[model samples]
Target chain A: MALAEPKTTSQTLWIERVPPIWWALMLFLLTMPAWANDFFLFQVMGWTFILGMIALSLMFLAGYGGMVSLIQMSVAAMAGYMVAIFGASGMGDISMGLPWWLNIPIAIIIAAIFGTLVGALAVRTEGIYTIMITLAIAAAFFYFTRQNYTIFNGYSGFNLVVPPSLFGVDWRQPMPFYYLTLGCAAICYAAVIYVSRAPFGLTLQGVRDNPRRMAALGFNVTAHRIAAYTFASVIAAIGGILLVWQNAQIAPGTAGIPAVIDILVIAVVGGITRPIGPFIGALIYVLLRTFSPDVLLAFGLSGERFKLLIGLGFLAIVFFSPDGVLGLWERWRTRRSRERDPLTGEQK
Target chain B: MTLVNTTTAADRLGSVSSGNALELRSVTKMFGALAAIRDITLTVRSGERRAVLGSNGAGKTTLFNCVTGDFLPTGGTIRLFGEDVTRFPAYERIRRGLRRTYQISLLFNGLTVADNVYLACRGVSRGRFSFIRPRENDALLTRSDELIEAVHLTPWRDTDVSNLSYGQQRQLEIALALAGAPRLILFDEPAAGLSPTERAELVSILNGLPGHIGYIIIEHDMDVALRVAESVTMMHNGTVFKEGTPEEIENDQEVQELYLGDGHE
Candidate 1:
């Protein structure tokens, strides 16, 4: 037997653990809230990071498992709703008033189980069929939450689902909340990077590339796909919990059809091929969404024209770089490396 | 589907008292109104190399699919090492140590050569689906690297599989089948679409295969099929037409008329 070479390329290694660029970016993000304005800190970067986690979850499915799940936003929304319905909230009459310790894990577990079920239904299909199955599930969940009052509180969802007021600190405060979102985002990011190199993730990719071959190689393709959903759903659930905390509320609109597609847009725009593509794509989306309204108003256009701006931007990116922002980055890097190394050769 | 709770089967399974490694009885596959394979029965002892030869659409590939669990046979029984695996799923059949390669290379295009081989090796081992632990940490990683070297793919081990040449991909395909150290491996046209040099290399690879592992080489190349296999089973229109040693198969006049018709050499 030939001894095994390292399976991981440095490009995919847990996000270049000791890379100088990564360290520099980490330092900048860690210190942003210390000097930035409250709106800039929370509404801008904070929301970006939180939504980035949901996109990252989608990336895990699309990038590694070759699965596209439109129900990811709903999975997060479900976790968010669980936080309000199970724990203390402004809708105290509807809230069960359970302790945070019990409610949080229950929310994540329920979300994960729900995700796995969605995957089980969709895993047997591939490509467009998989997309349609997930989209249907997202649509069904949204309508169910919107119309069902007893369990989901109908259209006007439970509000004031605040972060845990633990350790003598108000977590919703700008500094505390920024740290919370940052920490969670970093953890999720690190996890996406790590798991992509992990055995389960590799097997999942193999299944994606060639399910027939993987089965012949003694792998349970369906099981791997379902397991992928469970893992991603839990991550999305965590993001949902953070999202609910960010907005301090949940509503039908949170898991609406458009929101379901937004996560897909974010994931693909980031280049679903790379682990960090979702975050990069998320940053561009949030910036366009947050700043374009003001830019539109300056041009005698209504603030609602941000959607037009976002649509135009999305089309431009997709047209030029179909693989999304990461594909563009990869092209530039390859060109630059060719100039520098001379003989390392361009990546095939 | 191995019954860990049942002590009786395990006790009987240890001694290989019977010589037959495979026994297919009256196997038939029907695609709606058409029968793809009709009443195919064949037996091969452990460590025996058999080749199935025929022109295209002769049900050779279909037979391979049925045995590998890609499609459940419309009728019949397939016993792998004395155990009935007719109803087992493809992955289950693989775990029972039945492996196969596709007519076209079915490799992981998104991963490196090393990663692809590691997946095959890791699949046969315990916890092939360990979520938390990276496969790099698996002891089989070393074996995967070794297999890559054995197939002369170490130089391209880190390269994405899609970048490799067709011949190299074929080598990796064989290496993947070998990585599991399977009890019986089914190769679907192992030398298909190869250059003369590549064909020579493939013949050497097949000829040098260890005797402990049994193989069923599906080949269009007469020289390759005859050289690598101890016996030949000729197929025609979804059924076994003839079975004999290499010399016996080469001289059969009826076999020539049916198999090597007007167009195909």
Candidate 2:
């Protein structure tokens, strides 16, 4: 009977649909620059948002599209390289000194095309084959960037590739960069949420569930998969651009195998099922990578043991809850709800 | 049927075609040393209702797959509405007003019934990749609702497909095939696991389809098949064994001794 009721009016008021906790979280993030120190704002939160955005792209492909692509980090790196080569950079001879407006869009478009090409190759396969194919492609990009000196600069990459001063605001400054990344990350998160319910996203999920059925329904499954990669690459490309601006540098190691794998780890550890999961995973990863060294040194152990600590934590979390932190949170919430009396809201 | 608007592109194509909804010439599918379907030649007229009857391993499903372009025929050409589509992909064929249902339910388990039907409706129509969610008055949304109601799954419209019962899933399968404006449909065992009541409802639904749309059903249930189909083509060992009216096929001595006498009921 409830299904018979009109859903439009209720759906239109999406602001009211968000939980109160999310509003509080947004408020906290908006005011973070006032309370957070420079190191925390620029290094910790900025890095978290940048990495989270990239992981979010991976989550979009893996969670919704049923494609666990390892090429996201490489796509992001490609964007970063494009910015360095096309925009002003320390490598004055190699950099063409194009306008920021021209370079930024060029960077995103190139990365998306690369991603679409990768999708064309990878979508021909399924499941584990997809992962292997994407990984191989990512590896190829890494090696190419490392060996090609003319365009990519090989070992030493371009630096001084800072964000352009727009409206007299130096965006590379801690507060501005934090806000910039925060704004971009929020837009990406909201966009993913919105598109997940759109026709394209719904059909992508259908393709994931049953490609044959989707074909029978008249959907070009391969084309949909490729389009998904293009969409994801744009997000990853944005994140990559922000990353280069934050560090004022771009290098082959930025998109190396370890870095590419880290994006996958971040997506999975954050619970690749929902859009927020990638951000949550990135926050934890950033916090651990930032503070765990000092934490280990305080215990009189070598700071290099931080990787061991991270590995242990990753193992424990995965062992306990394969869906990641979001899964655990959902389980706890459901359990709490079940314990409460439905009519009176009293704990049982 | 309201689903089959006469002015639709598929109907227009139907009118201009040679009137054969589907034509297969010397179609053959081979997997290594074994031939799944061999030298199959068949034709169905526009708006014709035909049932393909066979026992297990009769290549009925394989033949359906070949026609729908799920599996490419190793040898012959398949012409849908007078257009040779032997090299066309599954979606290409589907876009040319062809649709099919699987023997086993191939539904989006994570999606709701309404979403599933809406996807089918979107697949055939324009703006399939639109980022905007459908508004309440979206034509496709209304059509999907009509399809859901047509299949009698209105109560479960918001229910996830995985949560639906077998009979409900079967109904949804039929609704999916009927989406958009299909000029030809291939049904692989629509009543395989349905309850008797559901089978009767399915028969009624099949019979009630618009006259411009044609379908070939692969069925093991003789009663359900004969009731809905005007003609019957019996397959044995990947080849056409008999072809006649349902009554003629039922009374034929070879069909009875080889198929019916084997207790297929």
Candidate 3:
């Protein structure tokens, strides 16, 4: 069927169409950390935020730009490597060293340039070709980092980079770092929301839904897609820098093809339809990856098989909810709300 | 065989009275062995109401594509407001005050009817690439309201376009094209798939178009065409078959034999 407008005036503006349940969920996330232990808070929650940020960039590209880019993680890894190479602790210790301030901005700029170039090439193709092109580029970058010890520091990768500090606060600490990460994530999330509502964002959606018509309406579809990729890359790069600071290292393994695929899984599991889905999916993955072995050991199972269990869980979730966990939650909430007010119930 | 034969001045095309909004010179589009449009020449003057009538494969849509920059013509010159825009991109054409509506309604289905109109209006009212705020200025909203009023869609303004009936969706598409306040507008089969009453309403809307905005409408219905258009260009076999007023074309024996007469058999 041809695309039709959904009911309701405000629903058209996706940024302003937040349901009450989402707002409640967001509040719950902010206030209910009292139950989280230190390990759960620092390692599980922290990694979730970082991975989620990275996945959100892909979500934006896929959901809005209608372009699925598999190299988002590789772009993030590039940012991580930049931080490792330029941060005070990483200096010649990793590769070619540079000042922290100078390198940080330069790395981001370089990532944006690379992303724009990648987008210009990838946007020329569509569907599976787009995926393959991005994957190929990611694979090439991975091999470049793995074999080039002179620049990338070889298979062991770069380490010893630390988060910078200011105003008498050590940002790398559990609480301080969590807040820093949260702040950055929030800003990136807001930026995505803002761009999606902008004219460029609207045009991208038009192109995605119907390119032939958009072309007739006088839009350059290729240019819009490239701009979308470049914008998403900026967000992914920021997440990469944050991840490097959190882990104090960067490695070729961090951006391998398999790792890039895992990012896609996170985005799909959480919900590609919305920005927050990445965070939710990341939380689930980090929790299982961190605790699955211990939980299995208690049951007399080998920790070596933990990955198999996570894979099963991933399959189960996708089979049950193709739109992801968030879609399921949305459906369930709508059902419950309808049950409460049969007379006034309105289905979306 | 010929009917209401007129002097060359009528076909001379360019004159200062209305001034040329768009001019096509020897435009031809070829796809390997086939020429989709061949040596087509036409002039669209400001405030002209022109209908492009053609059977299937007459190159009506392809000609629209060339004018709108969907594809560059294989050879020719296209001018907008007397300036050469033959090589300009589609978006640039829009930026320079040209806009179009599709045969099938192209409203943003997820957005409200008002939002769809507002977006197009914002494109024109607010400078292109301005990212200052979520909604454009209230002045722009006021203008959009005026446009919504003009298109007779104020009642469904708040409805999501996806939820609107097919007829309403078409109206909304016209509203969207009008939102750009374009100097030239192209309507592709605007009356296709409409109910009889809806068709009449659409024709009335087209006929009532403001004097400042020139329109090029593609229509299959000759009755509606003759009523709304002051001039008509009929196409056959990928080229202009006849160019004249509705009555002159109707009285022409060759045109009638090819289409409205024995051709109907």
Candidate 4:
């Protein structure tokens, strides 16, 4: 591991060489719970990371593949529902009482399969049509889960969905759960980054950029798009598992239209093109959701109206910089780099 | 056991069946009431350099599209090598070593020149389905760099297609066409937007390519068309009007009166 292989530009962009900023951020996240109280650790930062993971999955699809999938939350929520139903948690006569080993993989696999199916149906469509098809499917799934009581347990969703005990520790406890979420997020982040540099990911980006050109160059464009959805589904499914653990519940609202769209907002707000942008967007969103209520109250507005600020923020970001916060950062960096070295065009 | 033996023998024969690189027999394409291409019977032998020369709206581009499977011919059979690929999609044609450049450069403008060529290389390579292997490590990607050098775009190799000059994009476009290890390549209006110098460079590049690469060039520039192609087919009003060597077509009184012999030439 110590002997480094010389890397290409794409390899350098990947997880091969972890940046100092990322290292500092990871260290801070790892040690945060020790100093921070339960509310900050579990409710604030932990939930933020879970949402961030969900958004990151969306980012992976839209950013690299030029595919905007609205069914990402549906995939995640499907996994959450799987955890509730399969692993000894659902209400009377609903739970399957399967082992954790079976349930977890089954949840992820099913979500991946569902995502691929959605991709297959939507892959041929472009732009607005793709968005509409995915949105419609997500809405249909939401209603199906909400109305179907026999299997899904209906409007009053399943509760007491606890994580299994492993290594003599109650995995759902605050510190452990936080670590579990952080670890999964880190692995998923690395995997997404790694895959973006991988052959499949690069080809996918080509397909996204020019599907016709890609197809003419001998690539199976539909297959690549479907495969991207499958990869994105796995990321979302893992986040779903963490979400059910964090909240100890699963509901149709988990996959509802607003939640699904929120994932897209987080991705776009952070920077749809950058891997870390979705998480940063998620952080900004979570911070707003957490404290905007108080800020609204001081302005003699209802706490529920905090959502207005979020909406406005989204509009402002879209209007000013369509690429999101990351785009702004990139433009600024380029200008600075140009000022520093006109001849070389080197960036810091 | 007999079936297995027959299959192996057939596969061996199939690898190099007949020397014809491309065969289009009475191919026609109709769009609504208009026939875009009409009974285009053309055969390109292995290592053949041919030109499809005509005025604008001669259906040369349409013929390229039909042959490349951008759109299926309404009438006849299109064959690649020995295989009947009339019903094959564009991508399938590409997989079978049939490649073409567009009249308008259809490149991934957001991606780098290296990335563009890398994609072209990856498309035909056996590891096209590899999910985890980084493209940077692919032996084919290294080969794509050589293609960049071949087209004289090495200095702009890492630059984005959108940022490149029109001439450079044209160069990358040709590089991409060559990246697929194609046995047959259709160059559609390769000199469309190029300066005279760039046009000469393109002609030189085409000249330098391996002779085994069967090239069907759709060129408006008679100088370039005459220089690169040994034989020429002149199309007028969606039909082949004249077919002969560059000199024969140039000197033919009928061709001069009807099309190429006009002031445009």
Winning model by TM-score: 2
TM per prediction: 0.91, 0.97, 0.88, 0.91
Worst 10 residues of 2 chain A by lDDT: A1-10
**Could you tell me which 10 consecutive residues in candidate 1 chain B have the lowest summed lDDT?**
B1-10
Give residue A293's lDDT in candidate 3 (0 to 100): 97
The interface RMSD values of the models, given in order, are 4.4, 3.5, 5.8, 5.6
Model 4 docking grade: acceptable
- Model 3: residues with Cα > 4 Å off, grouped in runs: A1-35, A90-102, A215-218, A296-301, A337-348, B1-18, B124-130, B263-265
Show where candidate 1 strays beyond 4 Å.
A1-17, A337-348, B1-18, B133-137, B195-197, B260-265
Error of 4 at B75 (Å): 2.6
Better of 1 and 3 by TM-score: 1
Residue A225, model 3: lDDT of: 83
Ranking by lDDT: 2, 1, 4, 3
C-alpha lDDT values of all predictions: 0.85, 0.90, 0.78, 0.84
In terms of DockQ, the best-performing candidate is 2
**Where in model 2 is the C-alpha error above 4 Å?**
A1-12, A342-345, B9-16, B262-265
lDDT of 2: 0.90
Angstrom error at residue A50, model 1: 1.0
Over B1-265, each residue of candidate 3 has an lDDT whose tens digit, in order, gives 1111122111232223338888999999998999999999999887788999988899999999898888899999998877788998876677566778887787778767766765666554433343443443355555556667776787877777788989888887787776654667888988888899999999888877767778888999888888888899999988998999989877878888877658553
- Which pairs of residues collide in model 2? none
lDDT of 1: 0.85
Angstrom error at residue A151, model 4: 1.8
lDDT score, candidate 2, position A234: 99
lDDT of 1 by residue, B1-265 (tens): 1101122212323433357778899999999999989999999788899999988888988998999899999999988878888998998877766778889999988688888888887776666667565445555666777788777788998888889999999999988887654778899998988999999998887777777678898999998899999999999888899999999998888887777764444
DockQ for all models, in order? 0.50, 0.58, 0.23, 0.43
Give the per-residue lDDT of model 2 (tens digit) for A226-310: 9999999999999999999998999999999989988988888899999999998899888888889999999999998787777
